[model samples]
Target: MCAPKGAAALYVRDGLRLEPVVHGGGQEHGVRAGTENVALAVALGAAGLAADDLADGAPARIAALRDELHQRLAAAPPGCVRLNRPERKRLPNTLNVSIDDALGHELRAAAHGIAASTGSACHRGNHTPFDLARSLGALRLSLGRWSTADDIETTADAAIKSATER
Candidate 1:
């Protein structure tokens, strides 16, 4: 399902030159020069249409569930659970957090019913294997159209329980 050549489009303001991040490519003003992939573009458009077909209130419902989970998890002691990217606008379907004194393994084991993942992308590839050793408290939770209130409650309970273990 991967896109061929990995197509991407950028909008640069007139007269504004955004230096190429990875120089040397003889195409698109010296970028990852490659032949156009019409099939890939069609697949991407189909995926976009599929996403747009979700229920009208699906996004709002997902956001409410995310917020509920956040509230439940953050009800712990001050400084216990910290939200990632708090100062910036975040997607309504995702909630990432780091809980103080919580081991990644501990949380994982306790949260058997929740499909939560530990460690953030920003912490990975820093010469660390999964970055779980250092980011033991981090948990990247994603809410989807199928997620329910009960799932959110269970997730929060598991996280809070694990966080309190240490």
Candidate 2:
């Protein structure tokens, strides 16, 4: 899902006086608009609540596990790995590391036991680097509610071993 800030930033910086290029539905704060999706709105609200609940203890737990994995993997072998996201600023449950010689697709193909992604699922078949990585030169790894201490340990071990072998 797209973060809301980019569009909001454009509107704020450009002023709200632009004319519509195409018109079908009613106006929306001088931007193009259609009928609001009530169901989606409700779902978003529910998600916000769920996120709030997850924020209570999830961040600290995930951060601890992530730090452990990073430290251990970084200590494993010389020139084997590099963490993509800064440890402090990164999302707690996410870990993106680049292997010096390993292609993301190859790791993904061989990682049969771990639930991980080379990048966003949306751009999987595009044969291009992840947009964020293209802009900043980093891989992307996302973790979710089901991610666990075991998963992190297992995945980090597999990643380090794979990178070393390659």
Please give the TM-score that candidate 1 achieves against the real structure. Answer: 0.60
Question: Which pairs of residues clash in candidate 1, taking residues 3 or more apart in a chain or in different chains?
Answer: none
Across residues 1-166, which tens digit of lDDT does each residue of candidate 1 receive? 1233565546777877666566566666664456547777676655553356354666678888998898898887665777765634778788878777676667777876887777556766665544454466678898876788989988888777767765
* Residue 17, candidate 1: C-alpha displacement in angstroms: 20
Residues 92-132 of candidate 2 have per-residue lDDT tens digits of 87777766556776666565576666666676566654444
Displacement of the residue 11 alpha carbon in candidate 1, Å = 14
Relative to the unseen true structure, what is the C-alpha lDDT of residue 29 in candidate 2, on a scale of 0 to 100? Answer: 68
| Residue 13 lDDT in candidate 1 | 73
